[model samples]
Target: MSKFLLSALFGAAVALSSSAFAADQTLAEFHADMGGCESCHADGASASADGAFEFEQCQSCHGSLAEMDDKHKAHDGMMMCQDCHVTHEMNVGQKPTCDACHDDGRQ
Candidate 1:
């Protein structure tokens, strides 16, 4: 292969590898960005300690799930709270809209 082709392949490989690594992010990394462990793990409780996430805890900050669900009823089944919000620091505005998957003009 020509040097140019080899370099292009190397660049593409690196990009793909980096994306893969990003997809495997640890919760700790998310905690760091979204605020320290206590931000979500209130009262010194550990999320890993129980392996459970109480949606109620989030509702304390983000509002009731029922209300949010009502607002998002149109995109139901397309995504869930975790699909877009991996952490408490998630900016809802940046989350993918229903159009991302429902953009086939089926609506």
Candidate 2:
């Protein structure tokens, strides 16, 4: 193959590889890459009295539970995004499990 073709292939491979590992990055790391805590929080880096501010920020980017698929719509108003997301304790692409709240074994 030509040098140019080899370089392009190498670049694509590297990009794909990086994405493969991005799912393992912490939520903090992923958000920091996009902007920072402020992207998900208000000024002073403190959560609002009822965490409404942070929740709004999340919906601003991720959409409301009602707007999501059936699984998410089911818990629309029953819980806050943080209740399951728990950014500090969750990874970027990790799906929250239902086993925590339901013992019947559901993902």
Best by lDDT: 2
Instruction: Report the C-alpha displacement of residue 1, candidate 1, in angstroms.
Output: 65
- Give the alpha carbon lDDT tens digit for every residue of 29-58 in model 2: 667565567877788376678888888878
| Alpha carbon RMSD to native, model 2 | 9.0
Considering only N, C-alpha and C atoms within 3 Å, which residue pairs clash in candidate 1?
Answer: none
Candidate RMSDs in Å, in order, are 14.9, 9.0
lDDT of 1 by residue, 5-55 (tens): 457557755765676434344544543444456645655455544433533
Taking all chains together, the TM-score of candidate 2 against the true structure is 0.73
Candidate 1 accuracy as TM-score: 0.36
Best candidate according to TM-score: 2
Q: What overall lDDT, based on C-alpha atoms, would model 1 receive against the true structure?
A: 0.50
